[model samples]
Target chain A: MDVILNFIAENLPMITILTLATFVGIEIIAKVPTVLHTPLMSGSNAISGVVVIGAILLIRDAKPDEYLTLIIGFLGIALAMINVVGGFAVTNRMLEMFKKKKK
Target chain B: MERHITDFLYLISIVVFIFGMKGLSSPATARKGNLTAAAGMGLAILIALFSPAEGSFDNHIWIIAGMVVGSAIGLVSAKRVAMTKMPEMVSLFNGLGGATAMLIGFIELKNYQPAVISTVKSLLSNGEAANLMNGEVFSSIFALIIGAVSFSGSLIAWGKLNGSLRDNIKLPAPQIVNLVTLTAIIALSVMIMNGEEMNFALLLILTVLGLFYGVAFVSPIGGGDMPVVISLLNSFTGVGAAVAGLIYGNNIMIIGGILVGASGTILTVLMCEAMNRSLISVIIGGLGSSGSSSGSDREEVVKEATPADLAIQLKYSERVVIVPGYGLAVAQAQHVCHELEQSLEAEGVDVKYAIHPVAGRMPGHMNVLLAESDVDYDKLMELEPANDAFNNTDVVLVIGANDVVNPAAKTDTGSPIYGMPILDVEQAKNVIVFKRSMSTGYAGIQNPLFFGERTKMLFGDAKASLGKLKEELNNA
Candidate 1:
């Protein structure tokens, strides 16, 4: 308990930014008319796929005793990779149609 | 040595990402925006993989293997995915994201030094040692629980949407169970907060239970309610990512996670408005099976119109409104619908599409369908504007859309969708409904709107009907 509070007290600024970002994100998302809501969902979903970076970073720092971390990191890498590659690919497929409208 | 340069690169990537999102909002620049976002992602990943801080990855082959296997699966499935199955694809892909986040937290729990005095003799008094374990513990465990829920819950939703789950699995008093499970998780969090030694063993067990908790949470939700469920689970993955971001203190991950979480939540709110239901009611979920609404059982006379007759209706109409529903998605008639719209427009008849907020599977389901068929974004109208346009619309050609255009949603107090907002196609001068059968919508309630004097029903396959109309109109 004390450790958490102390950490929060130290990183208060970063925590505040995260909190603020969440609210600001909601405001921006709410402004998106429902017409584009599906793309919005998929686009943001692609963003969540960014966790692959965290997995890669973890693998780079793996210690000898961190065998479980290694296995989990392997799985994370694979899964997150799917999200990143598939999400971007699908969203791009949908978005390209919109560009055709311009022509 | 690489940390400073990598951080600078990360900064550049984040700036580009922000610009990409801004450009994504409009149709004209959306493709460019998607490419720009991909470039930023490329920059971020290149730094992480090739120029990461600290020690380099030891197992190059395993990393490459994971990448290859995952890419093959994602690419093949995405390529083979039909437009009709896009909802399931989105749900399943989002689940993978959640599962990955959960695994990161899982393996992270192993990084904690074993809880023994002999093993940690040097850290027996070291505040730094305790702080390291305590600091990451909360976020780590938190991500495990939520991500597990998202993974399992989304898989179940995908099954249901694809017709693999035929029945809405009923759980008696699910709210009670959901409440109990939630409270237990909170108590568990409090334990972590108060420094209960942070056991990985207990968290692993809790994660298993959390997986079940997701199934428990979603199974009771009725069939018609899957859109909200899918959206909510999509947000759950984002929240999981957000927690993962905190563990690594990565700015782009943090920003990305928050962006997804907030956007999904807003989309859920919009869905609630479109359904004319409260968020609480939707979450409670099992009410869809109540089967309690009492009304007319006798079949009413429906005015049937043939394709040639419908073509004639379109030829003379001054303003035409096209309401695309889920059936349109199933029939894959969006291309044909757009073809018909153009034929009408060239003849100087103004044509627009009416899109209910919850019309198809997702908020933008109808739009994507129409856009894929190259329908201009300017022609798509929302609920309010659609209803407004209907007032002056000479004919509303409802293609496989039933519940959204049903008048009972407004006038019939006993209707299941009463108090729900609906497209007032009932107000249009002439309403032509195209559907497969006289059956009710997913709501299962017989729509009196079908029996209304001004409404005419065209029964057949939506795509074929549109094909015939397109052919006839083109020849004219």
Candidate 2:
């Protein structure tokens, strides 16, 4: 009801930012051709690893009695870590293969 | 003041991410771009962890344990994985992102459990708790559902890639079941949004159904469609993370997630065009699964050539194009393929690599393989330009590639790959293919280029054949 409406009104700025970001993303990606697609996919996947920030935010808010929350937070951090670390590592490895020849 | 600093860092990270993606668009700067984006993520994590306005970690052991274990998994797996196994690894990483977001939603729910229960019970009694059904609550639930689907769907994709899953989980009218499950999720979500009374059990049902929806969505897909499925699942992870970010008021999270979501979506659309198939037809799966267009109409006499013969023709040719596909990756033949190019180059023959969009297990897979072999970046030509080059080309050497060069894509409307954007190898002056057998490609579509008048089939393992061919050309 009014709560939902107020929530939307308060977050209108974030929503607008997200929409604009998506358009910008589409514009940038449209310029990348097929040969660069794999790197593009892996690189963007690495970027979304920003969710580790969300994991940290939730974990810090947890109290001692909220064990389930604590454990979920830890696991969430671990998964986000994997996405961030593995994604960047893999993308780098793939990108290294695309180096210009020295000669 | 501390919060302001942290918010400022998030803004900078967003900019870095955009610049990183821009750098990745070109081959020369891609590695630097990846490192830059990684630095951005690292800064964002540091700010969130230490900012005084944000909640601080009380248990050092738990947080440290998560970081150490997660970093070990990421570092070890990424280094040790072979280039051929890149697709499943990408799927695994994407799945983890989705799973992380899902768990965060669950953690948020744990914090709100008592209040949620009381509010729902109050709503059942027609009280004022309906106001509790706000955006955060909706976003948390959205994260829960979307994250579950992305996680489970990626696992299935991994299994399919590794061949653990025996077949597509085909039941009669899976489309109906998929439709029903989707409708149920929407109906339940709306009910919760409208503040209809519900329980944790109802939420549990929704979670299970969401997971089921993922399984159903991808279970029927196999073969050439795997790339599209992987890209779709990748976008699902991004969407899940974006919703979770909405709940947490994390601006960088939203920006990063949207970028990923939008890129994945665009990639899928581009792939559909490369295959000349609509998105709807792609979702139906079983595509190109007609079982390798093989053993059909062998009336034409297929010419054969040995490495010695190929050496003679390529050594004298003025222009040569080499098209490599999944077979090249499977046989680990890129090094030799590059050597062959260098040998041909020494003879003053213009040698270039023709790359088809879906040539390997993933999009742009051949580029990675060729580039790894230290082939010059300028030598790789994409399908359209490569096709145009074929008209003036003296010879096209195909290494373990079939689908991309099949002339049926252009001439035979009755073929499964009739409309696919194949490399115009048939238009070249001479064609020589290296393979282990007359086997059809992953699409099970037979390549007419194999049997065309000018084609010379040199049957052997791609690596062995390329090695022998390189040796022959070197000596000549």
Candidate 3:
């Protein structure tokens, strides 16, 4: 229990940020109308691809001899890139249709 | 100093993301919102590449290769995928994101070798290092479990959406099996957390169990419930990414992931509410699995109509509303439907579309299809307004829709879909439904609307019927 408290004390700032961000997320998303749910979903799906930073850091910090770790990191970067690119492109495509219709 | 700059940029990305999301609240700013979010992502990626590294950047080639290959595939698929297959494509991308998070977590845990040794040493002393190590390990395990589940569950959902997998796969005592698996996973995770050394085999086993739980969780869910499943899995991927952020101490990832997680959760709830089902019932599956039972015993009196009759009725009507469903997509008839609407409008009839929230495979699916065919956005009416207009509507042409317009939802208390909100099509003066046969809808229940006092069934494929209706309208 002491150990857990010490860890929380050290990372209190990050935890607080995350906790507050959750409410902001809910507030912003609740206002979106149903007509844009698909685009909203895909757009946020793209945002979650920010994990690519983690993958890049992993690859950056790996030793040359760590072939297995490097391979895994490579796969991580590739998959995350796919998610980010595909999600945004598909969302744009859907929204473009909506745009043309409005005109 | 360099680390501070990168962190500042990440904060900027978070703010941009918020504004982008806010812009999606209406149709007018939606396209710009998507573009702004993409720019933010691009800025973040560029900043990440040049950010401070603990070690010299040795894997630049691999990173660039991965980005190029992934971009090519993403662009090609996004450009070529038919709008009707949007649900499956989104599911596939979400699964990829989950798989990426799982892989990152696995590497993070495996690379914590130095921390393990120090943790053991600190355990014999004051245990300062042990606390930090434990926190990192906890985040890694959380990300791994959630990511693995999202990955496999979303793949199953994608398969079901694309019709590559069967609608529902019945497992023997699935609930019990899932409960056991979940308990085992929790037990294993706790053991790993409390252990002094890294248990690689146990971690592997935990990942496998998570993947197994995902398949079991989604196997029994009917296809009609896929939107809820997909939304839930999307949130799982988001939460997994947020946990990965925790492990890496990346604020951008934490905020971005939390936003997606919250968005997905809201969408899941909205989908369930549209069908008047709770999230628990959706997860338990089997809502529409049974054959038609309640209204099957009664004599079904269905009225039949021809394309000419519908054409004549639509021509004389002052107002017409079309309710479209998944069948419209399957028949690839949105363009023809649009053409028919135009011909009716040429005769001075007011034409509009009534879109149920859960009309197609996903939310806003019918709107996307109608928009793709160049339908005016102003003519699309949501449920409440459409219901109000139905009272004054001269004719309601239900194209390939069944459950949404089913009067049983409002009147038949014993019906499977009772208490669900449905379009008030029965209140309109005339109703014409385009269907293939007397077969039940996705819910596997009989729609009493087919036998209503004013209902008429034009039995044929939706595309053929719409084409014939267009020809007849032009001839008249």
Identify the leading candidate in terms of lDDT.
3
Q: Alpha carbon lDDT of residue B365, candidate 3?
A: 90
Q: Name the TM-score of chain A in model 2.
A: 0.86
DockQ of each: 0.59, 0.62, 0.65
Model 2 residue runs over 4 Å out of place are A1-7, A100-103, B53-57, B114-128, B163-171, B191-198, B289-301
lDDT of 1 by residue, B40-63 (tens): 877887776776444444555555
User: What are the per-residue Cα lDDT tens digits for candidate 2 across B73-125?
Assistant: 89889999888888888988988988887777665653454234332112122
| Highest TM-score scorer | 3
Per-residue lDDT of A44-98 in model 2, one digit per residue for the tens?
8877777777787776766666677778888988988988899999998887766
Better of 1 and 2 by TM-score: 2
lDDT of 3 by residue, B432-468 (tens): 9999999878777888888889999999999999999
Preferred candidate (DockQ higher): 2 or 3: 3
Model 3 lDDT, residue B107, Cα: 78
lDDT for B386 (candidate 2): 93
Provide the TM-score of chain B versus the true chain B for each model in turn.
0.88, 0.89, 0.93
Candidate numbers sorted by DockQ from highest down: 3, 2, 1
